[model samples]
Every structure is written in C-alpha cells, then in structure tokens.
Target: MKEHFKVTQRMKRGVRIAGLALAFTVCGAMAWPGGTSRLIRKADQAFELEDYKAALKLYASAVEAEPSSPEANYKLGITYVQLNMPKEARAALQRAIDLDAKVEQKLLLPLAEANHLEHNFSAAKAYYEQEKRSAPTLEKTYQELLRKRIAECQAGEDLMRLPAIYNVSNVGSAINSEYSDYVPVLMPDDKAMLFTTRRPDKGRKSLDANGAEQIRITRMQQGNWQESELFLETQQQMPQHAVVSVAPHGKELYTFFADKGLHVSYKLQSGDWTQPELLKAPFNQGSREPSLFVTDDGKFAFFSSDRTGGYGGLDLYVSYKKEDGSWSEALNLGPEVNTPYDEDAPFVDTATNTLYFSSRGHNTMGGYDIFRSSISNATWSKARNLGYPVNSAADDLYFTLSSDRSTAYISSDRPGGAGEKDIYRILFH
Candidate 1:
C-alpha cells in the first residue's frame, strides 16, 4: 500500500456496505479447509449481522493467516470505511489494488468514495477515473461521466460567501402549494416566469409511488403567480414525478424527474407540444436521480447521474445534444461543484451565464441549500449559498424567477407551509 495522502486526523464516514450482504458459512471442504478466504467471509458475515466487534476480530485473524490476499484486504478496507476509519481503509484498499489491477471496477468505486469522504479529492479522482477507464464496455460511458464530477473541486469557491443584500426570501402562499414544487425557470426576456410544482390539479392521475407527484409549471402574471398548472398532460405517466428544467429558444423545453424518468420533446407547428417520450437507457435508467440543462448552442445538455465511480451519491454531469436532438452519454461536472453527498437540480442560465442548484455535500446550513456560481467556457466557479432567510433551517430548494426577475421562488418545509413541504417565493433586488 502506498501513502496516497498523509492521514491528518481520523476521517469520519457513513456506515453503509452494499456488496457485503451474503451469508458466510464455514463451508466444510472436501479436505481440510477454513483458509484465509473462509475467515474473511465469516468476518464479512459478522459485519452484515451487525456484530462489528466480532467482525473486526475475524478480519484481524484473516490478515494474520494470509497476509497477502487482495480479497481479504478489500473486505478489511470496506469494513474500516464503514466504521469511518479512512487511514485503515486507504491502506487496505491500496493493497487490494496493488495485488490485482484486474478486480472489477466495482471495487474501485467504493475506494473512490472512501477517498472523497476523507477529503482527499486528488486520490479519489485518480481512483474514479481509473475505474471509469477500466469499466466493462457496456458501462464505460456512464462511468466516465461519474469520474469527471469527483474531480471538480475548486479552492476559492468553497471558502467565499455569497454577496450581502440581495435579501433572499421564501415567496409565501403566492406561489407555493401543499406539495413539492421546485426547479424554477426564467422565461425568455425575463418578463414571464415558469417553474415546476406538485400542486394538485383537477383529477390529475400522474400520482407518484409516494402518491405525491412532483409536477411542473407554475406561472406569474401581473405581479402575481397563478396557481400551478400541469404541463403537457399527454406527456405524463401514472406514479411518476417530473420537473421542467430548461426552456431554450423561447419554445424548446428540458425536464427531469424528482425520482427517475426523463421526458423530452418540442412544440409542433400545429401549435401543440409534441408527446414527450422516455430517454433511452445509459441516459435514462429509471433509477437515475436526474437533472437537465442545455448550453447556449443547444449542442450540449447538462445533467446529473450516480452511475459508477462517482465520489458518492449523485453527481452533476453533461452530454452532447446531437443534430437530431437526441442526447449522448453524460460527462461528470468534476470536483469543482460536486461532492460526496449529492448535487442535482441544475439550472444553467445562459443569459446571465450563471449556474444554480442545490447541494448537500458543501458546507450547508441544513438539508439542501440553493447555490449560485458563474459558468464560463466549460468551467464553473465555486458555488455560494444563496443565504439565511432564503435558505433556512430546512431545505430551501429550487430557484424560480417571478413574472419578472425582481422576485424569485423556492420551496421549503421550514416553519410555515400548507403541508409537509410547500413552495415559497423570494424577492431578488
């Protein structure tokens, strides 16, 4: 094992191990058995059964028995990561990688995650990119995008605070409803506004699995927001939740799911919007927690996906928008704007050329805070929290412009709300 980064202090990590879920039986071998593999298997089983103390002891014994087995080392590394011992996990995982460069990239995925949790972005990035490059052909594309995000850290951005006196607000009953409404949009020319919401409609049937459908399109007219109206009913499906993300060229629209699902289409010459259809797999895995945005030229589409080899959780990514308007595989946003918790709900405004979204991994005051950053030539500045009143003790998510840019919209569960979560608007000076 190599000293990738000097261990400063003990690193704290989350306790979740996905692959170590199988039962380990001390199998009776045809001949004398119970070798190092068996011992490791037993230790892993003990971990699965919540017997941490027993698992630790068996792992130690396994290492003593077969001081050089990569499999044993990997298991040990993973256990340490679960227990928040980055120093031990790093040593163990590095040993596993050294022993066998051929292990499924799946193993590197966890190591990359552990490294990021330890705030060793450089090492985490190297591991993530290696995993992406070595992934099975079928998944390499997605993995590549995941790698980009893990390497996106920007130094100055993390430490700077948002400017004072834009006096952020949580638009009251005027815009929000008794449901989850987020992912706002500023209409062309900034006079009209558009946003996504879960406000109930007359007998709308597209209820999500949780029975709360996060839907789209709340408008503001004459200095007031009209109660939200569902967009393109023909494009909706039962038990599905959706949010419109980008509106390009005054007529084109981009949308993503609160859960997983993607719908894209354009308005036809007949004055009716085309029926929305599902984005294909690798791009639309009903399991991807997704977000979408398009560049000024519409040649590239920005999105977020968990995929594989990510630092952890969901990461922001991008894909090319083909001539036919179909989307390509995503590209990770890298270490600059992404972190281990999750980054999604991207709103890329080409006019002001600023990017805004919610992040849980950055220094947040609470659940999820809306962040803003400048976008310049395929690069993004560090994101700054929109702040205090606009960002509260709870989630202050999704930023929508009002009928005019003078006011903005958001959603939260803090203090006042019609239900568990409600929409609120903020006034922008």
Candidate 2:
C-alpha cells in the first residue's frame, strides 16, 4: 500500500530540493500568533519523513499561530500539495506570497503544481515560467523535469481553452453525504446505482477518521436518484470493502481486498447475496489489488494490481476466462494502455471496444487524470485524457459511463464538493 505513494525519481529530486529551500527561511518576527520555532521544526521533521498528514496539521497550527509567517504558509501550501489537495494549496501559497513577495520565488514550483492541479492553467504556466527563469540554479535533471512541467502547463492551458460541451453538476445532497461517496457502478438497466461511501459507521469501533468504506445503493425514480441506503446483502463483509464491478444483470458483484486481491459475490435465486468468494488463481495473486472491471458476459476482466512484472507501481491487467471456467494467466495491457506510472480503475465498454481508466501517466495535467483507449486491429490505441472538467488536477478517478453513453459519472476530491470526495454527473453534448 505504501508503494502507492511513491513518485518518480525526478519528482523526488525536485521535492527534496524544494523542501530544503523551504526549511531554511528566516523567521524574523517575534510575538507572532501561533508562531513558534518549535512547531516549525516539528512540521519540517514530519514533512521530511513524508508524514504529510501530520505535517499538514502542524503547519496549519504554525500558520494559525503566526499568520504573518510567510514560511508557515508556504509549508502549509506544500503540505496540501503532498496531500493531493491543490485548491487549498493554491490559497495558502498565495497567502504566503502576499505576506512576503520573496516567498513566491521560493515556492514557484509548488505554486505552479498546485495551480496546474486546480485547472488554473494560466496561473500555473506563469508560475512555471517564473520558476524556469531561475531553473539554472538547480540540478540539471530537475531542470529538465521542470521544463516538462512547463510543457504540461501549456498542454493543460490549451485543453482548457477548448472546453468540452457537457453539463456538469453535483448529484444532489439526497444521494450524497457530508463524507466522501465515490467509485460508482451504475447497472446496465440504470435502475440502481451502487457505490462506496465513507459516511460514519456507528457499529465500527476501529474506524478511521474518515470512517470505514461501505457499499451503498440508491435507485432512480422519476428521473432523480433517491436517497441512499446500504447494500445490505454484502454489507459488513470487510471493514474496508468497496464494490468495483457489478455484473451486467446486476446479480454478481466484484470487490477488492488488501489481503485477498479481488473477490466476487453472487445473488442466488432466493434473492440473497452469497458470501464473497475469492477469485481463483490469477486474480487472487495475494498482493495489493485496488480495482476490478469485468466484461458484461464475464468472459474477461481487467483489474489493477501492484504485483510483480508491472510497468509501474500499479498497472492494469486483463485475464480471460478459460473453457473450464478457470482463468488464464493475467496479461499486462501493454505500454499503450499503461505507462511507467501507476494506472488503475479500468472500465471496458465491450460494445464499442473502448476502455476507460485513471492513470498518473500519459500527458497528465497533474495528479491522476481519466483516460480512454479503444481497441483497434487487436491492439489498444494510445490513451487519450477525458479532458478539462471531467478530469482535474487532483486525483480524478473511478469514472463510470452510463449504459447509453449520454451521461457519465466520476469521483473527485476537487474543491466545491460536499466533502472529501463527491460523485458528479455530466450530461454529454
């Protein structure tokens, strides 16, 4: 699971240098509120150890105590970046720049990254250029990576300019809670929607602060998704269970586990769901598998796994169902559909032979972006980003297209949402 947090070597070098620069800022003011050298030291230590959540709290305290401390705001902004929250990062970084103009030059890369992630391409490009002016002072490799970031900003700017024609809106409060609700699986019939949510579980004593993930379902009635209720048949099976794929008939469901890989549950003729059965052999390789996408007929399945032989931390793999009802050895989707970076959440449209997923590779604007690739001539084409609003600078993932392809849904932690993450619906043009 920790491997999921790993970044590329180039990014590591940039962050390391940027962090060292941030650590040395002079704290000249005395009697500043919440400002303490001790707090800064502790935050810095936590940040250096990649304990971003802890560093975020400490830095927030430092900023509260010393609102005038440019360094504190800078640290808070960068901490937010590490936490994959670019909107908050941009605000904190901007405040730091306002407090001390010099802090802008020191935090140019983070400012660029945060803005880029938030889809503010112009601001991100400007910051990248400003950082580029001083790029010669850094290592050669990092400078090259910085150039790539600048190009990424330019790409994002271009994409944002030619916006897609789609009506995007929140799915409404009735089906959403103050907590995160994501990874939706809308059945082919479109009558029921199943998803994972982090709303409080009153029965779990060892739940995390965000609450244990549980599966919930809501029905569509009179053209609106009604209020949500737990998917009782498979509820409470795992402390952190998530529904990844549902059969075309909505009678079978697939879920992932850190210890067991991917498993499935079937609804019997009595209309009660059976206990989740661990998928056989190739699908249950006993590593950290996070997502699963199966074909409607159950002939093939695509799943995300971090097991060995991957091109990146997690790569998408497909396994075919053998004649005997067993599975063939998992086959990597190859470099076209995957990259030297993590890829997850594979959704296949067998009708069009299209595959949609989220990836940290392939010309991403920032963080993870949703991408789609279709098969032609028996090979997958280059993955294309879903673009602009459907994808954001934060980790935009868990995308599901409706049966008719006229509507789509995605989960994101992007700002202006109800909580940590929210499901959004987009009506295609």
Candidate 3:
C-alpha cells in the first residue's frame, strides 16, 4: 500500500479517534488547570484535523503540565500510535491506566494494539481477551473484528517461532530520506529503479501540499545506488503521480493520477517518455484502484480495486489482454483470496504463477501483511502469510522481486525505519 493513502485508513481503523466533545468532558470532569486545559483542547482540534505532528507537540505539553491527568495521557498515547511510535504509545497508555483505572475502559484496545505493534504478542493477546470479557455490550461487528485481532495476535506468536529465511535491510540513504520512500519498482535487469517519495520538494514547506508524492528514479553505478532524481517527465504536468508498475523490459510505465485514473507511458527510442495516456474502460472503474501487476508475456494483468459488488473493501481482480489490444472485463480473485478487509498491492511471478498481495485480514499481526497464493488448475490457492521480518506488526506492502528472485523489496513503517515508510531489501537465503 502507498503510505500516504493507506496509513490514514489503517490508523483510523485501528485507533478510532474519539470526538472533541469527549476530550472536553474528560477534562471538565477532572477540572484540569487553565493552561493544561487549553493545550488539551487545541491538541484535540489538531488531532481531529489529522495534523498529527502538531497534535503530538501539544499533547506532550499537556501531559507535561499535568502528569496525573488520565485524559491527557490517553490522548498523548493515541497520538503516538498515529505517528507509528508504538514504544512511546505503550509508555503513555500504560501510564494513563496507572493514573486512573477507569481510563482502561477507553484505552484498553489501543494499549493492546500498541503492544501488538511492538511485537509483544502474548501481552497483546491477554489485553485483547480482557477487553472481550469486559465489554459485553460491544457491537456485533466490532466484536467479530476483536475476535479476528485476537486470532492475529495468536498467529503472530506462532509465526515468530518459525521465522522465514531472509536478510532484510534498509535500502540506504541513496533512496531513503527522513520523509517517506516507498512503492519501489525495480527494472528487470536490476540496474535502475523507480519509486515514490513523500519528501518535500524545494520551496515546499509541508508534505500535505500538492505534488508531495513524487515519482523518482535512481540507477546502480559502481555497485551502489546513485542519488535519486525526480522523474521530471511525470512531474512536468501532474501535481501527484505514483508509479504503479513498470513493464518487464522497462519500456512502459504505469502510473496513477488523482483525477485521470491509471495511465500508461511509453519510452521512445530517443530516451524520453511520451505523455501518459489514461487507460479506457474495464480499468479504473472504481473509487480506488491503486496497484497493478502485468505479466512478462503481457497476456494478463492483476490489480486491486474497491469497486461495488466486491466482497468488501478492496479486492483483487484480473483482466486479460484481448486479441484486439483491449482488456477484457475483470474477474474477481474471489473469497479464497479476498476477505472483508482490504487486499491490495498485487505482484505476480509468472514463473510460478503465484500472486502476492497485502491484506488487513487473514493472520496479520496488526496492519497489512504480505501473502502469496498460486494458481493451479485456474484457481488461486489459499493465501499464505510471508512472516517476519519481511512483515512486521506495522503495515508492509508493495512487495516486488528481482528477476532472479534472490532479492525483493517492500515498503514498511516497522520500528527502526529511517522514516514513516522506507523501502526494504530482502535477500532470500
């Protein structure tokens, strides 16, 4: 998943931020001092607006001003969760519970989630079970979701016992910055790569501005990746462009535009790319279609969409190229591969006819985890989680492989990362 689009959804789904009125009620009941009360109110406003950085600062001040305030600590903890700082969230949330046992009713789930994200599966499972036994009145759907989360924590516990054989490492400063660098699309030969970065451009003050998500390209020189440069051709006209997939031979590029849908650009013989052309019907027919994978033979294409009639949120679908050079109607990958939660960022290895994607359902430890299912006799096998450290408690998606399969790339916000989401290189042993 692209960090910009999916992170917000993941945070909202996991934490379910409360309203400003609730914060005020808690503050009013506690009778917080004047200065701390003002800070909490302003912090709640920033948090509601999704300005997490600003909210984090304000919440921290509120906590400092009134160390014993359960409401301030609870808000601070949730803000840390939004910023992907699970360790800090764990500290603040645990402190809130210590200060006021009643705050546990409000923060128990987030506390469990913080522990899950920190890879403390056993502790998280205990907390989740406690919530289940205590909250007998939770809505039916939410109860079902809680059961899934508890199962996921159990899965995390079991999967940790059998870690996969892979050496995962950061892609380094050449391709990563303190902002976000993700959705890496490597050229077939492995000499060049294309990716999306949320790093602010020159003269830009904030990532929230237009054109913040820009496509960049870098090439290997002397056994190291050269510093990246903006793919100027993509930025010349569009304010937002994300590279979805690159043709096997690197002659064509598939990109997504906010207003124009999926587009394809061809590389001319003169070493320049043509203006991207929007793909016609049967593609991009929904509110969101963010990822794509085309086979080397160009006979089939797999993509993710949230269009109507899907089993739930986003589901994977496939379309075949017709004899006349048009795409056929899409066929859903079906219930075996998709669940009530989102499935996205499809990639295929034609050699084995395996489909790889990220999903919020299945046995995900917390957020999205990569899974693989192969086609046999025209049916996709049950999806299998790739396991840690290729996947962590944090969201991990956009898994891409080198032609030889010796190395792969994925985007994740796992702990110790250089930024919000950084591209990681996984070497299969």
Candidate 4:
C-alpha cells in the first residue's frame, strides 16, 4: 500500500471529526473585530478541504494571534491530531480546556484520542469516561466507537506492563527519508533489501509536486548498508506497485498492483528482473488482494482478501498449488485467524510454520497491530500479539524476519518515525 493509504487508515481508525458546521460555529463565536476572524475563516476552509498541512499552519497562526482563545487552540489541536502529532495535540487540547471549561464538551474525545496515541492509556480512559458523561446524547454508533476505544486503552495498559525486551531503531537515513519508506523485504542472506518509498521524483521539488511510491534496493557492504537506489525495472512496470514479499531464496519477488492482482517477477541469470506476471484465476479472484506469501517449498500461498465469504473485512486465506501448477480455491484461515475486522500484510516463516500478520481486531491497542499464529496438526493456533515494542498504539505491518530470527523488520507509523511510515529494525534480546 502507498503512504497515503496508511494515513487514510489511521485517520479512519483514530481521528475524530467535529464537522465543518461545528468548526464554522466555533470560529464565528470567537470572531474578533478584525484580522483574527479572517485567519480563522481561512484555517476552517483548509480544514474543510482536507488540506490538513495548510490547515495546521493557519491554525498555528490563529493560536499565536489569540493565545487565550479556546476556539483557536481547539482547532489547532484538532489539526495536530489530523497530522498524527499526538503530543502536540495533547498540549493544545489541554490548553483549550484550561482556557474555558465549556470547551471540554467539544475537546474531551479528541484529547482522549491524543493520549491514546501517546500510549498514555490510563489518562485516555479517564478522558473517555469524562466525554461519555459530557455527551449523553451521542449517536449510538459513536457511543459504540467510544466503548471500543476505551477497551483498546485497557489493552494498551495491559500490554505496556509487560513490554517486549527488544531494541527497535530506525534503519537510518541510508534507506529512510523525510517521506514514507516502508514494506521492507529482506533477501534470504540478509545482504540486500527491497522496500517501497514515497519520495519526490528525481527532479521534483517536493513530494506534493508529483510523488509516488517507488521501490528502492539497498545492499550491505562491509557490514553497513549502502545508500539505496531506485529499482527502475519495477518502477517502469507500473505507476503504483507495492513490494509484498521476496521469495525465500531471493530468486522471485512478489508485488501488488492496484488495478491488477498480485504479481511475481523472476531474477534473470544476468541479474536483472524479468517483467512481472499476474497470478491467474483462483489466485486473483478477489477484487482486492493486498498481500501474499509463498512457502519456502512453494507449495502453499497465504494471502489476504476482502472478497465475499470472508470472515468479514479482509481475511487471511490460503491456497495450495495444484498438480497442474494452478492454485486451489482460496479458503479462509477460519474464525480464529480472521476476525470481523481486517487482517492483512501476511508474512510466513516456513521453517516454523508461523504466520505473522497485522489485524484491526484481536487485542489491538489501537489501529492495526502485528500478531503471529503457528499451524500445528493442520489447525492454526490462536493469534498472539507480538507485544509492546514490536506492536505499538499504531498500525504496524509487513513484518519480516532474518533467517536466524535474531533480527526483524517491520513498517509502522508509531511516534518518532522520520515519516508517516518507516521501516524499523528490531534486535531481539
């Protein structure tokens, strides 16, 4: 998936909307006799258009012009939330509450959301409770969302109490940039890696100009990763392609195309990739199949799809290669692995028969969290959360492990990342 997709998913799962009508009313209530009103109106317009970056700047100016205005501070805080800056959002939202107690009715849910993103679970639950009391007439759907959020906070608290003992670090500037860099796929030997990045085109001034997801490859030389280079072969194939998983032997690569289905490309003897071929029939039956992983022996393929007959949303499914080299009909991984919510980004460790994937359900602190299930006696075990450091209060996906299992890589949007989503290295301890 592209970086924009990740942001959209996060916004859908976490961010709350106050609606443009409420925003207009709030700005109008705080309208000054002069320039502040103009600024507020401009900020509201940007926010309404979903140009949050522009809205962020205008809202900041509004706050600077009126430090004690609850409306300005509240709008600024909401803009921060849209931008995924939880700490800044918490500060601005708290300021709004301090400026006027009445704003608490409008600000509590977003404040709780900010705290939830920061992993301050206890405070988030308190604010959620306060919001529930303040808004007794909230719509039934929204009330259910609040209940789910509170439960997630409890899950976060429980998970944080027994944090994973691992050192998680950014892969650094060699492969990461100010733009989204994620979906890391490592070679079997760990000497090279392939990942997708959403950076500006070579001659473009900024990502907004004409940015697109481009695959990049980096190789380890003398024990340090060399700077990445764009994988032009794959880039030339399509405007939108996501690196899914590399074949265990590194001879074949899997990718997803938006209009097409899952694809595979082979490494030629001369070291160049052949044009990718879309998987046929039963494999591409779904309207949307975002991920796939082939077993080391190449007998079984695991993927995720939202096609009919699924447990719900996107469910993990498996297909076995038939005698004629065609895939069998896809079968859901059963209710234990497929929830009513989405499950995606499957990565299988063939050696252990363990399936690692991200899901919107199952003990998630918030958003998607990585979970693993192993097959034993032909039954998939109940999925287990990978726990704190590897799984945060954000969408974590595309987990890949080194051959020795001492190290791993994952893409996440947790705080302190260089961009919306960055590939992180996890050193098991």
Can you give the TM-score per candidate against the true fold?
A: 0.56, 0.83, 0.89, 0.87
The local lDDT score (0 to 100) that residue 329 gets in candidate 3 is: 95
Ranking by lDDT: 3, 4, 2, 1
Tally clashing residue pairs in candidate 3: 0
Which digits, one per residue and each the tens of the lDDT, describe model 4 over residues 1-429? 243344334333333443222333444465433335678779888887766777889989988988887778888888787566899998998898888877776767677778888999999899888876765774444465577778889999999999999998888889888777889998889999989887766642232422566688999999678899977554444655778888747788888766678888888889888788988866687568888888767788889888998877788999998999898988889977988778998888888889999998888898789999999999999999999988888788999998899989999888788877888999998
The per-residue C-alpha lDDT of model 2 at residue 2 equals 25
Clashing pairs in 1: 148-334, 149-334, 151-335, 152-334, 152-335, 152-336, 153-335, 153-336, 171-424, 171-425
Whole-model lDDT values for every prediction: 0.58, 0.76, 0.80, 0.79
User: Please, what are the lDDT tens digits per residue for candidate 2 over residues 1-429?
Assistant: 122123324353333224233322322222334445699889988876655667889999988988888778878888787665777988998898898776666777777777776777888788778877876675454565667667666767766877677887889886677678899899879888998887777775323445777888899999999998888744575777778999847788897654556778898899888888888878766667889888989899888887888886689999988899898999999999888668989899888999999987787766578999999997999999888878766667888888898888888877677766889998999
lDDT of 4: 0.79
Mark the regions of model 2 whose C-alpha exceeds 4 Å error after superposition: 1-65, 79-88, 98-102, 129-148, 205-209
Question: Which residue segments of model 1 deviate by more than 4 Å?
Answer: 1-163, 189-210, 214-216, 257-260, 285-287, 323-326, 376-378, 401-405
lDDT of 3 by residue, 1-429 (tens): 142233334433443333222332344355433334778889988876777878889999988888888778888888787667889998998898898786776666777777888899988888778877876774554566568778888888888899998999998999988777889999889999899987766643333522267789999999788999988554445656789998747887888876568888888999788888888768877568888888877788899888998888889999999999999999999988998888999999999888989998888876789999999999999999999888888889999998999989999988778887899999999
Q: What is candidate 1's lDDT per residue for 1-429, written digit by digit as tens?
A: 011111111111111232122101111111122344678768867875655556768887887787777667666777665554567777877886787665435466567656654545566677767765665462332443343335332221232244345665445565565555555666666544555555555455553322345445556578666665566666555445555554566566655654447766676778587656666644776447567766646676667777787766777877776677667766777777888767777766556877777776565543466788787786888877776566653455666553345766666655445544666656665
lDDT of 3 at 342: 89
Higher-ranked by TM-score: 2 or 4: 4
Error of 1 at 133 (Å): 43
